[model samples]
Target: MSVESKKTREACCSKLKLFLASMALVFFAKAFGGAYMKSSITQIERRFDIPSSLIGVIDGSFEMGNLLVIAFVSYFGAKLHRPRLIAIGCVIMATGSYLIALPHFLQGPYKYETSVSHSISVNSSESALPCHSNHSLSEDETPDVETRTACEKAAGSSLWIYVFLGNMLRGIGETPIMPLGVSYLDDFSREENTPFYLACIHTVGILGPMFGFMLGSYLAKIYVDIGSVDLDGVTINYKDSRWVGAWWLGFIVTGTIIMLSSIPFWFLPKSLPKQGEEESQSKSTELATVAEQGNFLPEENQDHEEKEKPVTFQELAKDFVPSLRRLFKNTIFTLMILTYLVSVNGFIGMITFKPKFLEQVYGQSASKAIFLIGILNLPAVALGIITGGFVLKRFKLGVIGAARVAFAASVGSLCLLSIQVFISCDNAEVAGLTVSYQGDTQVSYNQQTLLSQCNMGCSCSMKHWDPVCAYNGMTYASPCLAGCQTSTGTGREMVFHNCTCVGEMKSPAMNMSAVLGQCPRKTDCDRIFKIYMALSVTGSFISACGGTPGYIVMLRSIQPDLKALALGMQTLIVRTLGGIPPPIYFGALIDRTCLKWGTKQCGGRGACRLYDANAFRMTFMGLITGLYLLSNMLWGNLYLKIVKRQKKLALRNQAKENGLEGESRANGHASINIDTNKDDTDKESTI
Candidate 1:
């Protein structure tokens, strides 16, 4: 090889490596941000005093942002400088990340609502008051204007909007990465090498969520009001539902990393030469000789023609309608989109709520749940994606084979998810909520149920959710509900005494007292949680095994020219329809399962204090299982169609070859004589 040729080849190789690294970096950064948001959903909810349904709306804002710009970017962006556009997107994502954390700074220090106030005077006065029938304060007394205003200011009125808008901006920023990056890589890399590159990108991308959730887990253990409030004065532990973490800190860290990732893209060229283009050009003469010996290469010729033709803006505009029409005409592509839509809907819902689910159902702390998902589930998914790519490459699976692999993985995941219904621990024993104070199993779920004979004279406000654990191991809505007349100690150590609710317990001593926070579950619950996590990790791995193969099936089925547009449309449709609605509805359903609801300082209902675990499990898992089953049926139909179409194409190509051979044989002798005469005439003319 010539020195110049070797130099060019080396330069091309270096550019390809740089591009791959850049793509992976951006992928990792974005994945980290998105996963961090998912992991912090519970914290965000508590911090803002919002219900699950409202939190869903907040979570879905990212998709709303994607819906605004994805179609235009995907279509017009292919004709523009893709690298620069991606860089700009990264900047926007960073800005959005910073914006999400802005509320944490703008708002006052986190102050959780508690029955026990921090004021020393108020504590002394409350302790001095003896047990009396008329001691209970009336719930009807409205707060004065000054107090209401202060409460609203303390609650950070509508500050969550910043988070929603910021998340939406993040969504818009992420719109360009996947469709453009994948198409760019596919265009520049060799066909056989594409899967490996994608697998690597995704494997790195999976690490983002792992790290993001890990960060979330760590931050969740720290108090949200860490520097602003006295940790000693705080009564709640990390396990309490009211605990809010330093959720904003991760956003700052992730945002900075994402901004750094954008720098290299700005310096990179708009496009690079196809992999091995130099080698192909060097072998042109030999390739032409092979072609003359009856080697057919229409696909290669078409590719060459496409590269030769420059795309104009007008031409792109004119071609849009025709291209869209052609894409939807393919039954397999449409079915793939539908199946993916359903699967994504389930996935979005599951990921958004899985941490909350684990915390409620299995009696695990929020931080621990997030940590387990990050450490165990995400790594398993990464392994599955890599293994799936290996399976495709090793077996050289075609479109139909890839579909089968995806379908099987979905079935396996669905089966495992179904088992979760039976794996849950029992509902928490909350007094006047999930169970009667008398330890009766009969549970009532009405507002009136909160007012029982034991504490009716105490005039306990139904609005407050200051839960206190009783000696009977049952938790009351508040100390007042337990008919506790006096308290001892201070902060979390303070204990209510002379509780009438303790009479319901069959113990001989009949000691009457209740402390702050919800009661912990039995030791058996921990064993159940371990079992659930093991099954969850296994299911995650199996489900992720289909990721690469399913993506390949879509990529292979689509035309090369429409690849970016198809991917963008798939994202647009899936994100707009699938991503935006699942959280809202799933949260709405989960809201119904909330046994105890917290009261906001501004005289409105706040976040849920406790959930009916059995109901939450059934609702969450049932929806996921149903969606997966539907996706599987669609895959089965799609597989049969692909097989039938392949057979037809094979038959048609064979018939065309036979016809061409017959025509050549018929003209063989006459063509040779004519060629000889023409050669003799040409020689005479030259002389």
Candidate 2:
């Protein structure tokens, strides 16, 4: 290989290393964040008893900060030396971590706290104890009750507000780092290696959440220990568990330290992007040139013009209008944006809701439900990046194809899941333990037990009693009597022995376990995790295989430079537009169709309780199947369109360009003939 080629390879390798390192930092930070977030919620909830909805809003607010600041990070951060930008971001992120780590000592003013506390006490008294005139009650009546109400409303509210502030501040620190780090590598790497660098960064970045969760979980255990302490014991010093001493806050402080230490490393020379002078000059040339016309005026006037005031809004608007018009007129760009928004919105919403849908279907907890989501998402992301990078190496795939394939897959999976859900919902079988009382004894019924009992005897109550009868190896005096009778003197005499007493038995409301016994040493989480793993693997495969192939088709049809832009547009459009369906459509269905068994406890709320096995199973199955199926259909249509567009564009562009070349050739031939005739005429005149 040429020395130049060798150098290029070396440089690419270095960029990849740096990119991976940065990504690792990002991943660790996120890992910390994830774990911290989970622990924070638990801590804040316990400390202040805040509602989960408020927490969600607060959590989402942090994400908003990231969204709003990302463009700034890309624009301004990109302008700065890559290392410097990264360092600055690191510093800011560390500061935010510190802010989050610090507990809010001054919770409103003391008087405000007291007033809120007083108001809550008063409210409690007003609700629980009626106000009566002195004369209304007897002289020896119970003294005006002075009950200690537990509602420390101000403390609770203040605690969450503080957490929100911490998170928000932390977000400010974090937002710039991502684009800074990623773009740094992009700038540093050659075109071919850019994607690999990006992937390295991404993969390494994933480690952040993993690390964060591990760290957070470990530290969270400390918090849990503190919480487990009995405040009832006078021997223990409860005062130490104050704002500064709180394990949650303390852990944040430790995390902040680690985050801060990484800041200086961002200044390392290795992190900087290598922009040649030519590239710099080219970029500078693109900016509008300002020339001061030979001012016949004094030096002062010339100086004033030299330091011309920043462009006015009006002037900027005038310049912008033409560009806007030009861009708006482009059908391709417009379509690209629309496609982006649709794809992004749809995919994001789908991922976000997948866990909830799973939780609903499989009768799993929120955390457990997310296993599938996590598995699916990482692969999806990986595939998207990998496919996008690899597909357009030679040919160019526009946004259309990427959008089509991504959406189609998303739609297909969603539809399949949705169908599964619908079938589950419509099916007759309950997910959890199906128990029925026959005469007296409660009998456990499942597909297996039911079949066994049915096969043993058509109307044998003894078969019903066999399962629970051996609960403790003690036989009950009264067992359920089947439709069996003994012959008596006058007629058939029905036996009523051991058949009058019905005892209530408790059953776990887990369908997976009930249907298929304890997952052989695997916790509910483990079993759910397996399913999540499968889903994730499937999603990853779909993304890698489907996304890459689709992009190849797209690039072959479109120009290379436009591919990235097109992809971005597709993501933006899909994400924005796709978010509406679940809340509007699925939510409506859930509201309209109440799936309750009519028991007072279950029926009070139109929808069954979260723990209700039958209710959960029905809901989840319905949701997953419906959504997956819809996704599948949508994806298929989008992919097909993309494929067609790719083929057409390629053919059209080739034909047009080829036709122009042929015309030029013919024109040249005609000109040559005329020149030859002129030469001949000149020779004849000379003779």
Candidate 3:
């Protein structure tokens, strides 16, 4: 009713609806940045000649950044202006995204190791002698003395460290958003409306990864140096292991989006009157908003005249450790955190390498693999989250009910996941890798030196991985390794003839011609790949359906005052243990399955050119299965704890009610007896 209150209310957009909309946009931008990074991970590995394990470390760097400041930020920022802190976090995140792209500019153009010669690889009617003493790589100059020196400098510089630092910055920037942002939304919103609000925000946030992956897929089709380099001379397609797409471009776009999303938060007020209240000044505006969706009724705040003081450092430090101890003391809460940690460990690893697995095991192209995930898997997850939120709101589920739903989803999804472990496709039949040059699958990774006597006469380099598919349906490591006497055409059109290795040096009459790129997988494998995707999407949806309910269980289990701290702790603990390590360990295990590794131009071992497909499948899927099973066990324990606590509370309340009734009855009886005694005394006096 006062002028000051009126002015604050008239600030054009101090409504919870506006806040929700802003949060949704921020969520979308953040998820987009994150998912885009995941999608581009493969390209990054190829570009830097980095192995999968090291890439895992780089991915974990984001979590590392969170470990630095999440706890302090969440607890302290709660009493301060949450919206403004979130704005600052977004800016830091944008800076990190920009930093991730820094290494790309600092390095030279990507030059994959290849033995094909652009100058002399034209079509030739007469086949050159396969046994010529000049051999394979002597024709083309891979890098001149100067370029070679630059490559050495690039390789030695560890440019990937920039990505690590940038990703870490992103992690730090992201630390506050979920804990502070979600808690802020929850604080001012009605309790009943909380689940729907969360669902809507998460549903919108899910769009970010969908778009991010789509962007990555689109960018994967274009060359990394599209404008700078001549594509005519490039021999590999996007399907080639050597291919590096424009991974840096998406970061630039995502960074800008995140920066722009920060703008609205600065304009937003720190606190709003809770969602259900009715304010006279904004009565008309609130009514219109309600049908603009059963709109706003802002509660009049008696404390509007009093500005809330900002939380100080001393107050936070004093309360933090004590509050944390109180939270973990809750059996259900601790169990829930542990359960989430285990599940997320599996998720981070699965999401990070799923694209690479598709490329390796099922023979999907990088671009196609990425595109399928964006189009299929992510949307299913978003739907599942939305469904879970809807289910909670519809049923008005309590802690026990919510836990049951989450547990059921976990079990159902686990069953589906078990099916995928057996649905894998056979490994690509590549000579000197998964098989011998003479069409035998009896090969070990260590047997690369003695792969075939057929290519030995050609003096081929095992380091070069320019694959050529022979007409007989066998993949030779390279033209030189395939004993191709001559080449035809250029770029993707180039071919080699008189490939003695493809012929096995047996039948001179047979035509042993080969073309660029590895052979496509058999039709049977393609059919099985489709089956795998269906199961993958189904499992993702089923598992994700539990997301909102599980989150609700955690939210309801803790004390109201510790909500922000609890959320922050969850991020800190889960990210540190679950997020940071899974990628590293999974990548290390995946690296062990490499049957053929590429070589850096300056000479160290490079990113894997080929993997033992069965090993990759077992390692990736097996890790996820084990983690999920552990989480299921924990989830079951959490449910039992919740039920036990609820029962104890019910019994305690009943006992207190009974005791109060008995005391009242006893008091009534004593009053009657006193009246009787007084009456008898009166009678005696009268007599």
Candidate 4:
């Protein structure tokens, strides 16, 4: 009813709201940045012609920076005006995105300049004619070639530089945003809403990468045919199909700016004491009152003078060291971090090498391989998000379980897919390219029956008919064993006027040996994306569902409010230990295999192909299986220990508290009797 009480309530609510908003921002930015950058690395490699190995270094640079600044950034952020720190973080992130867009325009100039240098050297050699030795192309040709070459090189360089610069700037921007945002959130939420709000932020955060992937895929598939044209009296070279992720980049630029603009909101302080804290303080006050009095007050008539103790800045400051310490002491915390590091390493490493793997093994184009990987990853991530969430909720599991299960599934799928890839690769090596002994002819079959189904009343038919069937009765590359009627002379069906049957029929053409020899392949891509997504989905499920159990166990072992801090500490340790030089280990393997197999750039004796296929499968499968088994044993043991400890601690504390209360009551009653006796003696003397 009092103004002060009302004011306090409103302030508490405001602080709580602000903290949630801040947390959501951080989660969104982190998840968004993570997903966006995962694909961006490949994009940069394509635009810059950078090797996959170096791409890892580039991507890792941001995390490396994070490791260096996390401690200081979080400390300063908590000490400063919460909103201002968050706003600064947003500005930094936005600037990064803007910078990312700049390289696109620069690439043109770089390309033009580089092309000019190459042209000049070639021109100098060509210009020295026999009759007119050392003579330039009549001033006219020289200027034209030089001008054209300069423009080409400049354009090329600019394109690549833009991609590199964009990624670098984005990395810089992301560094402060994550930690500061979370600290800002710490000011707002009570313990009860923390997990729910965190979940909301995570769910919303998924939108960023999902949108990015969708946008990127849409951009990738668009085909533009810039028919031949002359510009300023110069003929430009024809380009068949080139991906200009211009539109998608524009969207990214806009989103980055918008997110940056919202940073100012974090400046408003929104913090409140949690429900649990209030309850504890109330309990203490009640106990003090009961101890001072001779008898305990009735439940309804109990004193209501307890004041809510607000958390002070000084108290918040002490959180950093203790939070870190708890994580260090907890065994489960260490395990989760190790699991995550290994999972990320395997996922990222394999994907990075995928293009090379496909190119070498399947003889696919580099761009095509990269594009396929990107497309496949989308579904994998999407499905992982959805399914992982479901699993977490359904099984009452946490992030750890989802992660373990997903990783295990991914490893298994990778093993099978690897086997298929290997078989196909071997077939290519042993059978070699099938030389055409005779002209290949075409064959056509019943459209309705061959297709086997119709969609929405739309009839399915082959656009181009292949008439040729192998003498062994197989038709088409996919292999159909349908009976066919051949025209009398050509052994062709009479479905059409025997165009090839009237004369010498072309010898039946088929790659039967190669066809049978090839393996049925499975890929962790979008078309096959569901499979990979299952892994991510399962992993995320563990993160979400497994989070609660992990928290509960840790809570019993340590303290409450320390879970997030525990997670941070775990991150530092896990990265230090489990993340120990996987790249180095894998790099050594690649080099050793490259030398042993004698594999050269893109080709050689299939060493990269052989090693990559076998290594990726084995590593993922072995680690996943091992991680799951170890996690089960570890979690199981910890769970039992926690239960036993909890029971023992609970019973002991209850008995001790009861004994103390009984002694306090007896002493209070004696004092009350003494006071009564003194009062009666004084009254009698006055009488």
Candidate 5:
């Protein structure tokens, strides 16, 4: 090859590598942002003073954004400069990230519902009086709440809209990266190297979530309004449902990374020579051919017909419906999407609320729950993906083989998940919610039950959930409800004495003093939590092991021309129907388990502070298991169809081979007769 041609090929090779790197970086950025949003779901719910169901809608907004643009982008983007489009998408994603964090700057300090005023604390002599006084702690805040302007209240309630819009923008920005980038790589890359490139990118994507959850765990330990709010007055810790973390900070960090990921795309060309194309050619004649085509770009590689004429939106639009019809007509593709639809419903719902589940069911702090998922569960997922790739490569799995592996993983994971339903911690022994003031276990919540004669004189406000733990290993809704008249200490460390409720517990030897915050769960509950984590990690790993083969099935099932559009359609359908609805419905059902809800300043029920553990576990795990069961059944049907189709194909090929063999045998006999006749003619001439 000429020096110039060699240089061109070398430069093209380097640029392709750059594209692969950029793709991985973008994948990591988007995954980080998406996972971070899930990690901070509870924090957002509390910060916005919204229920799980409403927050769910906000979480689903990202998918909604993708639904608006994915089909169009996936179909038309392939015809344009794909790298530039991806760059533009990363920019949009960054904007959304910044927008999600905007609410924190716009809003005032977060004010949690508290019965004890930080200003006076327990320093006042009158506050230090015995339980006989009918002083209400809520009385001090009534005038402020009543005097609040309508506009101010509306402004605070509507701040969550910013978060929703921001998340939607993130969804829209993420639409093109997967479909366009993957198809683009598969277009220019050597066929054998494509899977390896994709595996690398996906590995980065999984790692992104790991880092995101770790970032969330670290940030959750910090106060939400860190620079603005004083720590002295903040009584709630990360374990408290009312505690809002610095959820906004991680968005800014991930956004900046996404923005940086876009920079290399602008420098990359629209296309490159297929990898190893030049290296495979070696003749002097081929070198001449390479020299002649040195300036040629591979933009026309994806379609020869497109080389004759440029593809346009109008042309593509006419074919979109027909393309979709072709895609759905393929039974394997259709069933695969259906199966994925059900599975995604379970997966999205499970991941979205998992942190909350760990907190409410296991009595773990938000930080600790997020930390565990990042450190343990996500690593298992990463390892599973690696192992799955190894299995596929090792076994040389075809479509049917891949299907079997996915089905087995699905079944194994489902079994593990079902066990989680039965393995649960008991509901906390909180007075009035799970247990009565007299220490009897009952799922009762009433004024009479909460207002027993012990603390009837204190006239505690039932509106707020200011929990205090008693000495008998039980918790009260609040200190006043515990019938603790006098208190010592300050802020979160404050202690209450002469608690009639603690005296009335089943344990006669228990003291009558109460301290701040809810009581810890029993020692056995801690052991149960560890077991739950172990099971959960195993399930995640088993399910993730099918990731690579499942993706291969997606690629192999579709026609070459339709791959990009089919992927876009799959994402649109799965994300819209699967991603959008799961969280909303799961949130709505989980809302039913709420024991005590946070009270807003405007007299509305805010986010839930406590939930019935057994109900939460059942509702969360039941929905996931049901969805996964449906997925496995569909997969079984899909697997059967694949086997039958392969059998029919094998029979047809075998018949064709037999016919060809018979034709060859007849021709061989005719050739032998001709040769024998020629030898006979030679012998006659010699005689």
Candidate 6:
């Protein structure tokens, strides 16, 4: 090659690499924001005093946004400048992220619902009854209407709507990245190099969740009211279910990163020459002749034909229905779509509730659970994806081979998930809820169960949930339920003395005092958590190994012309049905397992305070396992179909070759007879 040509080739390669890097950055930034949002779900629920089901709706809003714009963008976006479109999406995503944090600024400092009073003076002569003082009515005075109205005005629940809308906006912005970015890469890159590039993108993208979850874990340790309130006065620890982190901060950080990601795309050209265009174009004449003769044409020729056609609004509208019809006609593609739908459903549900599951079942702190997932599980997935791609490339596996690998991974993960059912820690022993004060099991959920013979004369309200622990390791609903008449100290350090509930433990010599906060579990629970993490990491790695191969199978099975649409349709179907419903239903079902529900400041129900561990484990794991098993069955059917089709095509080709050979032999004999007749005529004329 000449010097100019070599330099031009080098420039093209450089541009391609730049585009790949930009795409990877976009992937990372978006995944970071998304994973951060998932990590903060519990915090947001607690901060807003919303139920789990409501939180699920908020989580599902992202999919709602995607449903609104994905089909249009996926179909029509190909005609536009894709890089610029992605840049516009990043701007929108940044706006959404900022909007999600808007409520934190607009609302007052987070005041968590607590039965303990902050207004009481430590030096007061009279004992301060935390729960009853708010209702202390004098004989000559009626309740003040003005005071009641003022209190009602202070509690606002409407702020969460901003979060929901913002999440939806995020979904809308994220719509183009996967479909547009992946298609762009595949179009420009060499055929053999596509898998490696995809793996690189995914591996980097996986790190986003890891860092995002890690950020969540770090943030969860800080109190939501950290700057505004005195930490010394806060009674709850990070382990408490009521703890709310500074979840808003993460949104701000992620938004900034996404905004910065948009700048590079703005500078990039609308289109770049294909990586090997020179060499490929050299054969274009021959390829065009083959296409004209009605022979099999390469994907490049089809792409060229598509590019030659003008993309107008009318043309797109006319083609939409036929395109969709043509896509669904393939049985293998249809089955593959169904399998993906099932798999995504399980994945969405599991990820949405995994942190909550760890907290409830394994007795882990929210921060710790999020941290573990980010640090351990996500990295395992990243490694598995890279390894999976390597396996595919190294072994040169085809469709059937890829399918089998995916099937085996699913089966292995399913088995690992089944093991978790028996690995749970014992339920927290709360007085009146899970057990009686006298150490007997109780199965009832009614508020009346909170009242027992141990503190029958204490006159405690069932609405108050300020729990206090006794010397015998039992936790009561409140100090009043513990039969404590007086308290020493204040805030978290406060101790309730003369607790009659302690006497029920049959130890009269022990100190009859109950402290604030629930008791921690035994050391065995910690060991159980370690083991669970190990198994969880292993299972995650195994499941992720199928990621690249599974994607390849889907890509290879569809026609090149329909690749973009197939991906978009898959996203449309999977995200709309799978993403939107899983979180809502999972949250609703998990809500049923809640043993205790918190009360909102405005007198409505709030987030769950405690859960029935065994029930939670069964519900969460069972749902995931069932979905995986169904997907496995679909994979089996798809593999069988692929094999049958390959065999049929081989037979058809053999028959065509035999027919061509017989026809060629007959033509040769006919030519010989004509030559012999011509020679006889020449001899007769000469004579």
Per-residue lDDT for 1-687 in model 6, tens only? 677777767777887898899988998999999999999999999988888889999999999999999988887776567788999999999999999999888878776666556433354434555423343323113336675445545755678999999999999999888887787677667666777888999999998999999999999999987788778777677888888999999999999999998888887765555676543232223213222221111122344432244457998779878767766765677888898899899999999999999988887899998999999999999999998888888887776677778778877887897786678788878878887777666656678787777777655666656778777788777787777767777667777778877787644438888888777776798998888888889999999998998887777766555666778888989999999999999999999999888866655567898898889999998898889888888877777776775564455456556675356446652111112113232221110
For model 1, name the residue pairs that clash. none
Model 2 alpha-carbon miss at residue 21, Å = 3.7
Query: Considering every candidate listed, which one attains the maximal TM-score?
Result: 1
TM-score of 4: 0.55
The parts of candidate 1 lying over 4 Å away from their true place are 118-132, 136-154, 279-310, 508-511, 660-687
Worst 10 residues of 2 by lDDT: 512-521
lDDT of 5 by residue, 149-169 (tens): 573465476789999999999
- For candidate 6, give the lDDT of residue 318: 92
lDDT of 3 by residue, 346-429 (tens): 999999999999999999998999999999999999999999999999998877888899999999999999899988887888
Better lDDT candidate (5, 6): 5
- The candidates, ranked best first by lDDT, are 1, 3, 5, 6, 4, 2
**TM-score comparison, 1 vs 6, better candidate:** 1
- Sequence-dependent TM-score of model 2: 0.53
| CA lDDT, candidate 4, residue 255 | 45
Where in model 3 is the C-alpha error above 4 Å?
1-14, 118-131, 136-151, 154-157, 279-311, 447-450, 505-510, 659-687
- In the range 308-378, model 4's lDDT, one tens digit per residue, is 36546677667667555433444444544555555545544454454445543444433455445445544
Considering TM-score, which of the candidate structures 2 and 3 is the better prediction for this target? Answer: 3
- Clash number for candidate 3: 8
TM, every model: 0.90, 0.53, 0.87, 0.55, 0.89, 0.89
- The per-model lDDT (C-alpha) reads 0.81, 0.37, 0.80, 0.38, 0.79, 0.78
Report the Cα lDDT for residue 627, model 2: 44
Better of 2 and 6 by TM-score: 6
